[model samples]
Target: MDRSTGSGLSFAKRIYLPRSIGLGIGFMCVAAGLWPLQPQPWVWALLVFNGFLWPHLAYLLARMSKAPFKSERRNLLIDSVFGGFWAAAMQFNALPTVTILAMMAMNNIAAGGGRFFFKGCLSMLLGMLLGLLTFGPAFNPETSMLQLYACLPMLVLYPLALGWVSYRLSIKLAEHKQALRAVSRTDSLTRLYNHGHWKDLLHREFDKCRQGQHRATVALIDVDHFKAINDGHGHLVGDSVLRLLSERLALSLREDDLAGRYGGDEFCVILPNTPAVLAADVMERLRQELAEVRSELAPHLQITLSIGLAGYSPMQLDANHWLKDADQALYQAKRQGRNQVVSAAD
Candidate 1:
């Protein structure tokens, strides 16, 4: 579910029901107490809806599914489940009590962690605060200034606690998400960007070049006689050689250069803002670095790479056409005896 797009907001909206409902209930009750609502059936109904029914409903809904194991919905539902249970408990008990208030505060903190902590915590806290303020006079039967000051803890402590916990959890979730995204874009074996990511990024760069009135180069490199390496040294050594070459290419390439495992012993390097001459120089350096690394890994390993180079075409829509042209040139390099660089423009 490529949630990286605008569609990702839909995922968030799906799980918002429970928390939103609980928050709504809490808000109404708090509002009623603070705004001087005269004793009325509808106002009382509002209190009951906010304090008890909302949270309870959220909790019950969360328990219905055990699908949290593999989806992001699980994370969203987690908040709903916790908030719902807390809401339910509040309904059967005294709303203006410190114990119930504290529980609500803690539940809000847990439910709204990740990038959404502050907003979530504030939302839940506001609901409870309004509810308590609205119902405080009714519960305590005291309207004195001193009595109201004494009850101020009901307003502050819960929100503060909610804020602290939610913010902390938000940090943790953000870190976890970043780590996951990093792993997703990387090749497990070669530690370079995988083939799919390579294609995506290449096209993206190509688009940028088209808009910018600038140029970028793409180089396709194939390990010369890779089949023989696998046959003679076995797949394990072949794997080791590929890993070493990937590392060397990554380390030796300039910061603007992007390298990818295009599949098997083939690699692709996209050099942005580079002309053919500069790209050839870069590739020559890469060839030397890779050759040295190959010698170190296996003394007899004489691996060589045949490279085909092409540049961005402002007239072309995407990089695929240019890539195909580079690929044909690469085939020519192999035909003309491997271990050489061939330029499509040549």
Candidate 2:
């Protein structure tokens, strides 16, 4: 689902269950505590509606609205108002009154933090004032054992539900973070490592080579006459050619090999644990593979690759030196009439 709809659904779910459980139990506490005062039939009816039906009503009111989160926030404030009204109606009987106010405050804080909690408190006061105006100056400072027992279910279970929601949210966030990181690392078209990430791997491979006598070779591959390919067959055909070439290159390389699009029609590869000759051999095999490709873009056209190979050396100043060597060899391959592999001398 889209973010707003999913978020709305989550808000509805958050309210539906615990509110269902807690409010139903809360009504019983208020009912027992308010019994001595002999409230009107309408007051008992409101309590029944708030306890058994308000949760469903609030969920529908939020979920069906254009902006669910905002509607749900308002619903939470309404819950607090109902709590406050019930508190005054029951003559603020100690335990049930404390439980009602505390749970609604927690809901406000969880929904919109401290600022919303203040607003909820204000809503509570408004409800209390209405109750006072309706039935003046009622007070019952004591709580019976039965009333205290009724408050228990709401106090213990709702917080556990809140904790479970928080935990699941954390896991979903972590998965999204991992997916975003993967997108950042990959090239959009070729599905290979992008330039910057491939460069990082090159540097890491260089560092590993410097630590020991591990052999490694880097190659720069250029699609011969790539501009002509694009101009003659259109950019769409040019893109298909690049994708085809990348697929062939992937199939030719070993599992440990790293390949990347190095901008335009140029690609690069780092072959760990391979000598310059072996790297050239692999590229030569890839060259032969390209020779056999029959393009759908132009029936008579066959794409060719020019590759330059360079191996690690003690005399090389840095990773850039290795890259430069590969680049020089690529230039030589291009100059030697294209569609061939050239290796830098040891």
Candidate 3:
């Protein structure tokens, strides 16, 4: 949901209430400036509307608009206009005028930096002109202690509130970035690491094994006659078969073991600090486990895994060479017969 819309309030909307509360205080300072003049009923009414009701009204207007986010930005600029008009109406009272204008400037800068600052300045100036045209120019350089105290609350509290909002936004952005990275590395169907991520892990594991003189095993497992299964059953059933295998495979592995879906009907695993024999035993157990699985679509369908297991050798030059050894073993398993584990020769 758009945060700007009534469906959901966004971060900006979340910050607005604190800003409005501070603004109400700032407007009270403006009223203090205008008090000595004993302004007319219309002026008093305008002050009440701007000081008390405008913030809520602006939020609702944006929420009701076709594009709530965009409308909210426009509303911000309108706020600037009103701020400028009030500053002028107060006869450019030095303390109140500066506080009102500075707050508007700070708000625009926070929203869009220099660009929005410029646009907001333009709106403010236009509003100042409207005030000047209606009521003529007047100036009061002095401000009372009460008026100064009235402006103090906004100056101190508003920035702290805005800072909190910005901090939360940064944290949210970082979390979203992390989520996107995870999504990129994962396969949609199997919810396992994708081929590229698996390959990266393989490379890293190979490096660690070579550097630390540790044993690691790599295995490639293929679903025997997967094409025939898809042909016999519908694609939906074929997908279910893959999901079941992926789930069972995950459950069969140890905490430190890494598994990934290499492609259609082909999955890969990496086992650290394990010899070829131990890897073979693990793969064999996994094979039997998979064979016992009964498909919902065709309960009696014979399903099995052909796995090729190879341990890292010091003589192997690179990750690719080690992978090649496992691939060759996998081909040997298929050639010998489906549904068996083959260990590659060192």
Candidate 4:
């Protein structure tokens, strides 16, 4: 469905429970207020329906509408209109009138913010005029003990219900944000860090090394004859090979190490607090592990990694310079043999 429809569905679901509870409790307040005035039989029946049954009908109306969000907004206006009518119907009893109007205002502002709030206020005014015409204008600002007691449940319970709904919505929003962040930083194929995020991490690591806070090694890894594999077998097999290598890399590295897909067929790793010798050993172990891994898609296929390592050095001018050392060493490894590890400091 479209964005508006999706949002409307969500809005309707979120408002459903609060509306039900609010209207139910509101029935009591209006009933007690009107009991003192002894309203006609039909008026009493309308109050019963509005209090006990209207919330479900309103929810159904929104859910079945072409535009649920807009329907819900209209429903809110109807609620405001009823609130005003009741306030007048009770002859403006101080406690019940204030209670109903205040609750309706809270609901409007929460549902649609300021613009909708003004619209709801206008609807309420219309309702009050209708109420005055129907009941004949009369004033009874007095609030009895019984009226105050009836108003208490709505005053206490409705805000609590609204607050609970707001809290749940905030939590869902936070989870969505976190998932988006992870997706943005990850490689779609390998599930490793993406090129941009990996490079950002390299800059941070380079700065730490430059400040004498830590030592680290950077490695660039390439699959030997990757193009030949894709040409001979197919891109699907090529993808499987890359995924295998990524799984091995994740399994072999320390928790502090970082690995990323630098670009198509090329991977990079950062080993924090590691020297060139130790980084080379780690790469050699990874290379050996992959050499033994057989693809389920192509059982006879052989996988090998040519890796280059560069340890942090005071002589390097910047992060790019450090990366260049690793790149050059990678070139040397491929030059010497297709499947081997080479260290720049060596």
Clashes of each: 16, 0, 0, 0
RMSD, candidate 2, Å: 2.9
Q: Which scores greater on lDDT, model 3 or model 4?
A: 4
**Lowest lDDT 10-residue stretch of candidate 4:** 1-10
Candidate 4 regions off by >4 Å?
A: 1-6
**Tens-place lDDT digits, model 3, residues 124-235:** 9988998898789888788888778877877787777778877888998899999999999999999889999999999999999999868999999999999999999978
Could you tell which candidate, 2 or 3, scores higher by TM-score? 3
Compose the digit string of candidate 1's lDDT tens values, residues 40-98: 57665655665456545544444443432223334433433333333332331334233
Q: Candidates' lDDT values, in order?
A: 0.64, 0.87, 0.86, 0.94
Position 115, candidate 3: lDDT: 97
Query: Whose lDDT is higher: candidate 2's or candidate 3's?
Result: 2
Best by lDDT: 4
- Rank candidates, lDDT, best first: 4, 2, 3, 1
TM-scores for all candidates: the values are 0.61, 0.86, 0.92, 0.92
RMSD of each: 11.1, 2.9, 2.3, 2.0
Q: Model 2: per-residue lDDT, tens digit, 1-346? A: 5535778778778667778877877787888888888889999999999999999999988888887877888888899899889888888888988988998888788778999999999999988887887778688888888888887876787677767776877898899999989889888899888899999999999988998859899999999999999999899899988898889978888899999998999999999999999898899999999989966877787989999999998778889999999999999999999999999983
Give the better candidate number (2 or 4) by TM-score: 4
